[model samples]
Target: MQPFHPIPVSVLTGFLGSGKTTLLNRILKDPELRDTAVIINEFGDVGIDHLLVEQSSDGVIELSDGCLCCTVRGELVDTLADLIDRLQTGRIKSLSRVVIETTGLADPAPVLHAIMAHPVLMQNFRLDGVITAVDAVNGESTLDHHEEAVKQVAVADRIVLTKTDLVDPASREFALFTARLMQLNPGAPQISSHDEDAIAAKLFDCGLYDPSTKTADVARWLRDEAYHHRHDHVHDVNRHDARIQAFTLTHDAPIDPQALEMFIDLLRSSQGEQLLRMKGIVAVADRPEQPLVIHGVQSVFHPQVRLPAWPDDDRRTRLVLITRDLDESYVSRLFHAFTGVPQVDTPDRQALEGNPLAIPGYKS
Candidate 1:
């Protein structure tokens, strides 16, 4: 039997009028994305008239650049499963990658979960990353009024700022908007939609593996330094932005495997919805020589990956979390309790388990 190589699936999401289609159209033109299969909600929604070459009998639209576009006839999982079946049966010539373009107002978490949580899909597809489009002109107001928009940006692996040419980069409004994004998701790199250099290579492959080097690029994948230097800008207490928090949790000591599992379970069970996204590399006490990589979208987590050896000299545990309606202090205390770090007024692991009410910021 041949070894199974999972295809990488990238999600492109944004709020209404955010130019998600525009960015996706530009991305499909790239030669690197030639064999990519784009899954969209509707053909009309994407407006690929210029790129459309012909439509197959099975509802797959072949692009001029050798890309294939298919609409979701049923569930996303069904579409993905069909794609896999086609590939295996030789109905589809080849498939290098998959791009799922979500509806404008849709929460990207469900889309991510469809790929991550499904047992069969998990084996065939690996989450590449999330690319979110933000309209520069209305992004501020959109985020202010729409929690969905905020989440789209919060969980993004890469943010493409659209209509940037209309807004003056030197303006205070633009600066503040960008700063707000940084506060919401410090680790995600922001790119301008108009950036000619923002090609398929730059936008995709944000997982643990760096295709360019064919090695595990933990440092680039985690981007913990961005969180360390996160902007301390204050937001209005009543605004949606205030509810979203992005922060890093670090510990010098190696954590026990059991304790780590307990902590993750408690967090996921107690406040999974609030946990928009989390990715970390940990130093395990059992295997001090090897590091564990963990990535999760809300409650659904990809299988933990154990690296043979530390990627670099920095072996300390680093976890970056992007959460919504969740307190950072609460998470910090929970970690400290599990890691056996002493802190005043924080309940220990036993106490937390014994009395769930003891968890700070937790509502029964």
Candidate 2:
């Protein structure tokens, strides 16, 4: 009736020849993904011939499984606007979700920025999750030489390891590749693309949405345990490659909403470029029962959402940050300064004078 509901948009990305097309083709065949609208960066990459595509008025094509496919011939904003217009006009009906498949050489941060920053698109769509495809046979080499490949894995909520059948399961190389992926992104769950059930279960509904009940799955989406578990494990020698790091910040006390706003604003203005991705569930002091859900990529942040109730008994404010060049101490110190929490050591007059903004107790 009203275009169904606010659609959850998922970003599917991978390096060149990482089997993104293969996975996409397979997903299109699934009846469960029937109500999805797919936006491919290039039309040539997808095969609409095999698909029983019903001709729509223009660019848009309806597949036999009841999905929609379109290409980004111009700007992404224009393409999305066109789709939303059609939905409202009753030309396209029963849209549940949308998937944007980015070019192999593309960086997903810009695409996310466009979606979150746009006024029209923001009203109709909510970013669900980022799913990245990695060729198990060549993922190691790709990460070694391509910064884009590293960022793709780092920002993903779920990683699909493709072409795993090409390598021996018991071989040392396969094991090493798996370990490397874990090191690079310990928070994201890794599943093989060959398993159709696993692919559907792990990838599609991984964001804040719970597909089984169509509700918010805040606890599962945050995945704070993945970062916590990695902390207790042995550190890899190559963990610090490319100045990329992942860490979690946890606080037992509730924080003032204004203070939280100031902290995030300062962080984004100062070191936003180094901030690859951030996600957290916070307990606001004024409303502890309704936790705030915040997520950001690079310099842009999505409008924070508040859940009706806490998903679990744990009410601690936990934030997981993945940064390219930022350090844990700097982020913690910055957060503490705005919250008026005492730092481990009081800054001496000379030290405070050197960098006045860093000290909460500093006075002009």
List per-prediction Cα lDDT, in the order shown.
0.87, 0.80
Clashing pairs in 1: none
Taking all chains together, the TM-score of candidate 2 against the true structure is 0.91
- Cα lDDT for residue 49, candidate 1: 99
TM-score of each: 0.94, 0.91
lDDT of 1: 0.87
Q: List the residue pairs that clash in candidate 2.
A: none
Which segments of model 2 are wrong by more than 4 Å?
2-4, 196-198, 209-215, 231-240, 348-356, 359-364
Per-residue error at 260 for model 1, in Å? 1.0
